[model samples]
Target: MFLCGSYVPPQYLPWSPGSYLFLLETCLFLLFACTAAGSAGSMPSMNNQLNELRSLAAKAENRRTETGIPRVAMVQGKIPEHMLAAVYDPMINVILQGSKSMTVGDRTLRYDPATYFVMSIDLPAVGSVHPSVSGEPYLAVSLTLDPTVLSTLFADLPKPVGRVEHNLGFSVAPVTTDLMDAWVRMLRLMGDPDAIAALAPVYEREIIFRVLQGPHGWMLREIAAPDTAMARVNMAIQWIRRDFAEPIGVERLAERASMSVSAFHRHFKAVTNLSPLQYQKRVRLLQARTLMVANAKSVMAAAFEVGYESATQFSRDYARVFGLPPAQDAGRILGDTRAIRP
Candidate 1:
């Protein structure tokens, strides 16, 4: 769960700085396209496919899989509570046997069996998982987003046409019968390792195709088209995560997103529910937690290494976020690391 890969294409260049005039001009000469997805109730066939997906993923360990499938992974059982606070990559996650709640900034969303959520950009979030009523373990699977793959599907699709959404980069939608069937094909390939190299890509496209037909299809469509607000905000996010330790100015970040400082800030917050600086802070804090608990680093050492100027300030912020002072939290989590490390 903590280990996920991100693949961005070469064509997706990082946005440049110092373009205030253009920023105002683009303040959305192009902005966003919005749609609602997944209103259909689960069908009988959806339940059947969902069951197969669960069985295929049943043996997944507490961590990611070793299924030999590229960019596909599953997890079952309790997550190390701490690892759930993370800077999550772009992916579509479907919870099969249990429910999970994800909190991005002040917003929290929950999903249960047969529900999947799409996050179109990197986000800093905290999450918790629960097992099914029958005591079935928490089970889920994920497909990491790849720009190259999504872009290839663009030619066959309709141009995105809809109302503009400010910064809604992630959304939750119910699983449809067709989508579940596609996942069934994708996961069934695991049983025939020899067939994967040839068929995985084929099934992968079908799965994405089903998702593209959904209401949140705009998310998939717009993200592939780099000029959209979601893609632009994604560019700014990559900048923040890349130089997280360095001091960042909102103006520079806005320039990178090709929006005015005010527009940029507004869009960024709309998408991430946090300001750019706050986003960086979360990345830092999450990294610091990993350093202390996993590497046995001291409070000040973890703080300084993650770019905090003052250990005192780090402690205060850490307590605010994690609900414990640095030293105490580290000590408590240290002993529990192995419980979830697998």
Candidate 2:
């Protein structure tokens, strides 16, 4: 059976330095050995689990069947030629046979077999999966983010021992063995629809549990604290995401989020590392691209759909942000949207 209790020192131990030293070294070595073995063993299992999920996802995609809400499956032979600008949502992605990477502003994260990434809020991201192995192909799975469950877990937790000055919306870390196993079980359930409705909830909760207890746990923690600057920034992020087409006034946004304009600006920039206008612009550009690709809107139509008044202005701003005017950029991006969201 797995050790389910927290690690605690024995009640009695000899108070001799020699004995203590030996005991410490022994325990340290054992800890190291466990960690090393767990880390190594986890990589292959993650790959295997992802492969299995990808296979199932491919079948579902081919049949145009929806697995459920929060999951978007790409089949084995299908690869998104362009990255996607995914909306504000909670989702986790696994790369089964190939590698994927996401870029958030200047920081870029790559996850292969050893690692995965999580985003707690609605943020703009660009992601892509590399061409897969000839036979294996790229496989991935996605699910929605749940906030109520996260809040429930943080109720009794102590204040952060030390707070980070900034918390990025997205983070990448090595996936643990426990998480890998939980994912494997979740993927396996896809093959048995009779069991999926009941089993999937349990497995999904288990995966979130692993996240709450894992390396990026603190990031998730920061997401729920309403008094914190990061929380305010998240509110502002939500506001912008929901109403991107409207004229965004920072003062109004700050007031809506219950902060003074200055505090709002400071905290918003601190978390997102972007000013209010810049953030909205980023959202607008991404939304415009999504509209063009998914809705088949013309450049002018897409620009208007995302709140741009002037097609020329939209093209100029789009070029500045994406380095190409709307038509050309949309064409190039539509060719492969997978690389756009991570």
Candidate 3:
């Protein structure tokens, strides 16, 4: 009933015009039918792969080490009402269950199991998980990207036909069967310690390769390209992250990136969707929050530690970003955690 590729029957074609037309139509119909069937067949396999990832994530939830696989981490948790801020590194987040939302500047990105998010450069973002109350939890696997590996892969792979000027450092892509299969194998390696040393690198490389062939491959490729504008912007971002507590002048940042101040501003905003000063402010606020949450530092002490000049100003800014005063928000987060615990 269905066929693929070049399949012709001698009985159906006797070198007549009518027979040739009928043969062509039949071949086309069979090709369509075969493609549809193949797609239907692959869906079950994809679902099974996602199930395996979900199982591994659930088992690794309370473990000290997220996963035995090197550079891979499993995250699973219930939804939180408040968004958590962090500087996301270069990594790929593959969702196997539930959903989550990330806010970068004014842009809001929501992704679920059908999509994977990639951070090609370090970025400050607010994220919130959204797991349903039906007992399912939000589960995801994250793989940190190694620039050295990306550089090597870019050199060996074919170059793009043309470059796009406007590229965001972060993107979300639909998960394909090939990508899912590679991720499944990478996760499976955690159970086989003997095979990991020899095979982990291979699987990691395959995963990167699959990403390089994806829609946002250009952004990932630019991460390793030293001469690209996106790379220069990334350098400035790194500088701001390293010295967020210090005052950063736009001119000095531009000089460090070897671009004109105006050009640097334009490119930086294009890539990160934030100006230099705004980016630094976000970094400082996030760092201060970390101090309060982890070290239990007082609000004023955390603010001053992150180089805030006035406690009142810091409180105002923190409230604006986090939706509450620093201490109160931190207390509420801790309280929520305690309430959620069994």
Q: Per-residue lDDT of 124-157 in model 2, one digit per residue for the tens?
A: 7666666455655555555556777567656755
Local accuracy of candidate 1 as per-residue lDDT tens digits, 36-76: 12323335568778888888988899877767788899999
User: Model 3, range 45-137, lDDT digits (tens) per residue?
Assistant: 989988887776676452223567778888777534333478888999888877878898889899988689998988889988867446577
TM-score of 1: 0.84
State every prediction's TM-score relative to the real structure. 0.84, 0.75, 0.89
Stretches of candidate 2 exceeding 4 Å from the true structure: 1-66, 69-78, 81-83, 132-135, 153-166, 332-342
Comparing 1 with 2 on lDDT, the higher-scoring candidate is 1
When 2 and 3 are scored with lDDT, the better candidate is: 3
In model 3, pairs of residues that clash are none
lDDT of each: 0.82, 0.69, 0.82
The weakest ten consecutive residues by lDDT in model 1 span 31-40
Cα lDDT for residue 186, candidate 3? 88
